[model samples]
Target: MYKFKILIEGYARTGANGVYFASPTSSLIYDEKVKVLVDPGTNADALRSSFEREEMEFKDIDIVFLTHYHPDHFLNIRLFPNVDLYDGTTRWHGDQEHFYEGRLPGTDIELVPTPGHTMEQTSLVIETVEYGIVFVCQDVFWWEDGKQKSDNVNDLLNNPDPFMASWKDLQNSRKIVLDRADWIVPGHGKMFRNPRRN
Candidate 1:
């Protein structure tokens, strides 16, 4: 069994031609001693405030998880240099899936290569005791008005070419995780409780 302490901060927006934002948050799994600092996006002030509210120092982070390299999901990685970082290898060379075991003890946290949103994209998941299972899906899925949207987008969702493969991989990754996950943590919205709530 595993236990996790999760906190949702706010949106980390990227100032590009098209505005991009990420749900910058942090998760700490007590059993594994793993602290995942999700995409800090571009809002340094929000990030700092969130960390303080959670009683966590930026220096205490152990891993930085980048759902994708779209700036909104990264940009803040530079905040931590001492911590070991993990992102889909596809972000660097636009190929290959990086997998490992026991990246965190007592926790089955894996860097799933969920491309599509971006080639260098990845998602984080944890098998927990209380929550059963939770995933830091980032932006592979979007939730609005408590509805789920599929892998479809317009200019509102314009993506780069290198991430095409990652998008396809994202679908496949979703299938596997949906079957096992009980909590769906989106990168820019509220958390989806497994079995859902009325």
Candidate 2:
């Protein structure tokens, strides 16, 4: 069985372009042999503080999983050099390569493609004995105020030229997540019990 904890709860800010909520929501998943971090976020200090609060350190991290290439989510990845890293898209930086798609070898966490927030965005379906199936879907659905909102879809639909995502794909991805996830940890809010389930 695996246990997970939210390292940082993401937030949003308004900008001239409208609401810009890029603060990355990060989490840690661990069980005996594997200690994986999901989306370490942009603030190094905050991330470090969170680690300290959890009684953890950089040396404890075994792997890093980036939900996408967005700076807010993938920027602090350099902090964990000793671990293998995976990204939502295929890209390279010197010797470090971001995986486009794959499983984490021996882990129950499945890196499922959940595009629409971005063409490269991915979400994880972690099968846990305590939580059933917990879905870590960053930016796939934004939790704001006290309600869940499909901000990504709104962005794509409102734009004159929607290049990064499609409406149909976003809807499909939502269905997939809602179907499989019993609990959801979104990109910009607290963890919540998925109300869509029966």
Candidate 3:
């Protein structure tokens, strides 16, 4: 079985012009066979420090998984140098490079589409002894009890961020994740037990 850790808890904020700036939550998934980094967000300094906190270094990372093509989520990705990456989209990069999908070749981890914040986004589903089922879902759900919105039980049902690619798609994706995830490491917040479930 695999285990995971939140390398960097993510956050997002809105400036003028509906300009959304985000810090993608980066997580580490490591098992006997592989070491993976999901959404290696934009801040290289922060990422380096997070690695230090875990007593790890850059080269230790094996696979880099991009949930979507957003810059903030992928900017620091090249730091790993020649490691394999799952570009998180079906179409060849708009440049013809293939994107990997389904259960990863050597692991029990599976990629499930959880779009809406962006049409091509995907979430990570892995079974772990410590957390049961963990969903590293990026952006489909914001912080618990609201992201930009005020914090409250309303956050449980108020929907994800104010900005999204499609509301209808997001709602459908959220239902699947919130229903199945034992715990979720959201795109822009600390990991939380599924509030609706508990």
Candidate 4:
């Protein structure tokens, strides 16, 4: 079985027109085989503190899973310069690149292509004995309050605050994730039970 821990619970504040800054939630997933860090958010200090508290070093992490190409979500990847990065579609390790379609090689984790916040946005899914099915979905679902209304994707797409790449894609992505996730670690908040699931 796999296990996960939230390294950083992220947050954001929105200002005027189209102006918002956020730090994506960072998560750690591990089993007997591998240790993966998801979305190493912009909170470098918090990340360092978490590592120190856990008595961990940079090398302990094997892969940095970037849910999307956004900077806020991936900024702290610099902390793990030597680790491999799975950027939704390709895994980058030093001078080598390995491309994967669905499941990442050598792991039970499933990579779902959940676009819209950005075109290449993706969510990492894994089933664990403790958490059941977990989806570390970045940006696809972001809210100021962790329990933002999700019963209607149309309402989400209609919200003027968020910048979306495609309404249709985000709508579908939200539905797909909500349908399957027992719990979700969203882009800029703590993990919560999937409202649609409960």
Candidate 5:
């Protein structure tokens, strides 16, 4: 079983458009053999402090998984240069592309495409000793006033902007997460249990 910890709990603030603007959440998962860092956000110093608090260093990270390429979520990837990175997209980073998806190559962690926040977004599912199936979902949904909300989906669907992709795809993705995840760690706000099951 793996051990997981939330290194950073992101925040959200409502904008003039009534849509909530969210910050990126970061976490770490490890066991006797595997050490993975999920979504290193825009703040490098904060991440560094988190590592220090956990008695770890930048060199200790074995794998980096980005839920998407949003600046808040992925801009700080340079902080961990030596580790393998996965985001399920074919994009170049300094002339090298490290694209990976589905179950992370050597580990049991599964990367599920959860596009809504972005076309290339991905979510993670991993079994742990404490929690049977823990899902680390980034911007697939958000929490507000202690209730899970999908304002982003509504915004994308209701808005007249032709650039936004199909909201149906995002709805299907959310269904996938709700149907499978036992516990959920959202991109912003606190980790919560699957209320439907409980």
Candidate 6:
């Protein structure tokens, strides 16, 4: 049997691109004693408040997973000094894919490479006894009631890129996730289940 939990800080609005500024939003998935902090948003204060509300502390965290290098997803990386950092391998900073193959203590956590929202954007899939599969996707997929939409294309277009080429990459990544994920906890939206419908 497996278990999971999602701790959302707060919502950070972004451009139509759906970046969500990593404001105060983030989540944690613990396999019993091993905990993984996924995408720490920009609000260290809010994060602390959330912990206090739950009577939890940062020291309880074991690792921090960064989906990409965007400001909203990483500005607070400095907050967790004790947590080991795991990020996408293709990022301008470092390649994290090299470490994706290992298994964690008493749990099964998989980091899938779903780039295109940014070159380094990756997502997490935690297999649980109850939830089946829960994905904490950074910026790879956005939802308008479970249906995949173009929120990201609009945002990414604002940057320098072969628009068509990037769009293709984004589409491919979306398909990859669609094939496996059942429950999705997006970085900046309400939690979702049965993610293909209203």
lDDT of each: 0.58, 0.74, 0.78, 0.81, 0.74, 0.61
TM-score of each: 0.67, 0.80, 0.84, 0.88, 0.80, 0.72
In the range 1-198, model 2's lDDT, one tens digit per residue, is 689888998865566768565576899988998988999998788899999999998988877888877787888888876667766554345587655456665577788898877877889888777777899987777645445443343432332222346667766777788778888887776676666653
Best by TM-score: 4
Cα-based lDDT at residue 153, candidate 5:
39
Which regions in candidate 1 have their CA more than 4 angstroms from the true location?
9-32, 89-107, 143-170, 194-198
Question: Given candidate 6, what's the lDDT at residue 107?
Answer: 47
> Residue 102 in candidate 1 has what lDDT?
33
| Model 6: colliding residue pairs | 17-155, 21-72, 22-41, 22-42, 22-72, 23-42, 89-95, 89-96
Q: Tens digits of per-residue lDDT for model 1 on 47-110? A: 7777898787988776666666666556776787666556644222224445553343224576
Query: For this target, which candidate reaches the highest lDDT against the unseen true structure?
Result: 4
lDDT per residue as tens, model 4, 3-23: 988888878877679687678
Q: Where is model 5 more than 4 Å wrong at Cα? A: 14-22, 89-101, 143-165
The window of 10 residues in a row where model 4 has the poorest summed lDDT is 152-161
Instruction: List candidate 6 stretches off by more than 4 Å.
Output: 14-24, 89-107, 143-165, 196-198
Worst 10 contiguous positions by lDDT, candidate 3: 144-153
**Stronger candidate by TM-score (1 vs 5):** 5
Q: Which is superior by TM-score, 4 or 5?
A: 4
Greater-lDDT candidate between 2 and 3: 3
Against the true structure, candidate 4 has what lDDT? 0.81
Task: Write down the worst ten-residue block by lDDT for model 2.
Answer: 154-163
For model 2, what is the C-alpha lDDT against the true structure? 0.74
